[model samples]
Target: MVLFAAGALLLGAGTTSRIFALTPENREAQATGPLTAYLEGQGENGAIWLKLRNGEVLKGRFEVKVGGSFGAYGKSRGIDRPGAAYEGSGRAIQGGSPAFVDMKGPSGATVHCEVVNDDANAHGSGVCLFSNGAEYWVLY
Candidate 1:
């Protein structure tokens, strides 16, 4: 079996598929359909694939741009200090970046996800908004 950091897919030459568990955000969608979503790193963009419990599948692609994170702001933090990082008041607010996802699901419906990650590791909790006016809590 292949493994990554904290279940995160280390974006290598392109051999990792990050998966996310989706929870319905609205009351009407709480009862049925659209369960999980996943992403596969492929260079600058990745393929976002989602499959519902009812057997319906949706195919889409997402592009990741590293922002407000470690590597992206190394020079700004401190070039002298090798491991210098930006710290906040509470643990809930750390100096990490968020990975955004845009998946076009079934019937022209779009899914937008914002996960806490460094582009390489697609891990964290976020939300996906379906174009059909449905929202879901996404955790990867």
Candidate 2:
């Protein structure tokens, strides 16, 4: 009975890991879906604000420049610090939807944000997960 229980536990763990494993295609889909929605609403220039879980505030200005690239600068706590800019190029995903964006911050941190655009209410929220395990809730 003990051996059976142990085997069951191992099998369950393996299954959980497999289920949570993120492949490249899954990663792209996860990013692209929200990114495409956010950019479509942003037009040429837009502003976004993030309130970190730790009470830090980050304000970002986004610009869709020529060649289909995007750039952003974020100010935290009303202070403009060096290395707080983000820039990336936008690409279409499998269905030709503009959803994949590869952006890196000034500190070389990768920022992953998922946003839903709500123009009518003007109260859209999203989450930004950083490479350093820091997360922020974005309000746009």
Candidate 3:
């Protein structure tokens, strides 16, 4: 009976370790870097926190606006699904607004992006598909 109990305990411990293991998804979410730097440039609000790779942090709030030439609100392009089943690529256009951080590249330089928007919008989930290439996220 003692031997059986010991086996069961080991199995349970292994299962728990697997459950707590670091995954790519979790790493990306926890790994702060360039994203945090850009957010710091934007300054403070109450809605979001930008964490830097070097251990600095910034806080900010963002509001979403839809109008004018900026795709008429709600209408957007290039959103990827979870599990990396879909993908798209584009170039960052230059513009000025609190909601968007401009991502620019050399002439004719295009980069890939995947949607990882986890926020929920009225239409559906807000998770965006993005890559580690040249791209920016609309934080709000």
TM-score per model over all chains = 0.62, 0.29, 0.25
Model 3 Cα shift for residue 127 (angstroms): 13
Q: Per-residue alpha-carbon lDDT of model 1 for 25-138, expressed as tens digits?
A: 696457554476666665546667776555556676555445533232222323113222111221232333544566654566565555444343344454556666666665
Reference-based lDDT, each prediction: 0.49, 0.27, 0.23
| Tens digits of lDDT, candidate 3, 78-118 | 23312321112222222221122122233322212222222
Clashes of 2: 1
Two-way lDDT contest, 2 vs 3, winner: 2
Error of 3 at 107 (Å): 30
Worst 10 contiguous positions by lDDT, candidate 2: 1-10
What's model 3's overall lDDT?
0.23
For residue 115, give model 1's deviation from the true position in Å.
1.9
Candidate 2 C-alpha error for residue 126, in Å: 1.1
Where is model 3 more than 4 Å wrong at Cα? 1-46, 68-140
lDDT of 2 by residue, 42-83 (tens): 333343332333334333433322233212322222112222
Please identify model 2 stretches exceeding 4 Å from their true place. 1-102
Q: Distance from true position, residue 75, model 3, in Å?
A: 13
Q: Which model is ahead, 1 or 3, in terms of TM-score? A: 1
TM-score of 3: 0.25
